[model samples]
Target: MHVLVTGAARGIGAAVVAACRAKQHRVTACDIDASALAGVYAEREGVDCVALDVADAGSWDSVLAEVWARQPVDALINVAGVLRAGVTGELDPADVALQLNVNVRGVIYGTDAAARLMRGRGSGHIVNIGSTSCLFAVPGNGVYSASKHAVRGFTIAAAGDLRSHGLNVSLVCPGAVKTDMLEQQRGDDRAALTFEGKRALDASEVADVIVDHVLVKKPLETYLPGGDQWKGKLCTVLPEVFLSSVEKSREKGIRNFKSPQH
Candidate 1:
């Protein structure tokens, strides 16, 4: 299958690109960080990289055109995103806008572009990367949660809108992945994930599952390592209890949101 993955420089996106290439599927990777993309898999068989800033609509169009010029895209994975942590009082308008623009608007643009191509082909899958934050709003990371919630909402609506035309949509929710992003958070004064909590996830593992599902069921959403399974089930069945547990966990350092020294 011909696949295009945004934010493919490293972390989940890079892992997914490698996995797809291992499967012998043609893969195109786009990211704003050209250096990071260059550091990743070289121009190997079935793998290509391009500079892409998902927040820019024109970049999306240019990359899509470039990919189509090579081969028809079968899957478009919207994996590029940004996150920030702040309560209402501490929230920086600029940070909030960055999150909203990149995390929310970026997905909207990608969704629209992917839907157009997928609908025309009458066969394709569009996967949007969501987060567990979409379920429970963290205290300091409300903006991050809001952006991810937007993703969750958009995925559901897009699923309905595209289903009649043979297009598939899935939201991939990953919990506490170990990545450069996580590393950056470690030093930030308002981080939501700590080293201990970060141990639970490996980006490559999540990427493997993504490749598996997109090739198989192409379901509405797939959570990495079954995070959505238990998380969603508990949140739905016992919201108050789950939320209370989260609060208790935070208090007990089960999930640390405090910053670590560099």
Candidate 2:
């Protein structure tokens, strides 16, 4: 199988590349930062590094053309995304737009492009990387959560649209993973205060699910450590109680965060 993975230079994307390779799948690792990709896969066999800005439709064309010229992609993993954290009263429109551009629009375009190629081939897979934010709202980082919500909706619609065409679209929603993006969230007080010092699943663990379960045995959606998503759902059932507990937990966590000894 030949796979093209966006955001492949680092974090979950880079880890997925390794997971795919471990299974002996031919992979084209792509990212906007070509240098970062080169650093990892310089002259590596069976792995192609290509520069792609998933937000740009034209860039998708060029990269897909390049990919098609070499190997008709068997799976397109949409992983490129951004997050901007702030509460509603203090929202930055620019940050929101940037996150929407990369996270929401990028996945939409990537899925469309992959569909075109796969529909003609008669069979293919479209795997999207979503977040636990798709299940519940993150207090400080509402925009990021909103974008993931859009991702979940779009993926479900995509599955319906492509079902008759022999294309399988699946969504993998993972809880906060230990990645650069997670670290960045820690830098913002509004968000970090809510989720700081929380150890998360490893990127490779999520990638393994992508390779082993999603691409191999396609499920409409698989939430990593499924219990996390169930917990998220339970919050929606009783928002007042859930939020009150969350606030109490947050206050406790903050106190512990500020003074380690006591």
For model 1, where is the 10-residue window of minimal lDDT? 253-262
User: Tens-digit lDDT track for model 1 on 1-262?
Assistant: 8889998988889899988988888988888998888778675667888898898888888889878888989998988988766768878999999999999989999989878877886988899998777675656677988898889999999999999999888988887777776766664445533332434477888888889766578878776556555766577578787666654455433345442421
* lDDT digits (tens) for residues 119-202 of candidate 2: 997899999999888877777778998899899999999999999999999999987677888767653556643353244678
Note the Cα lDDT for every prediction shown. 0.79, 0.85
Q: What's model 1's TM-score? A: 0.89
lDDT measured at residue 84 in model 2 versus the true structure, 0 to 100 = 71
Tell me each candidate's TM-score.
0.89, 0.92
Clashes of 2: 0
RMSD of each: 3.1, 2.8
For model 2, give the 10-residue run with minimal summed lDDT: 253-262
Residue 233 of model 2, lDDT score: 79
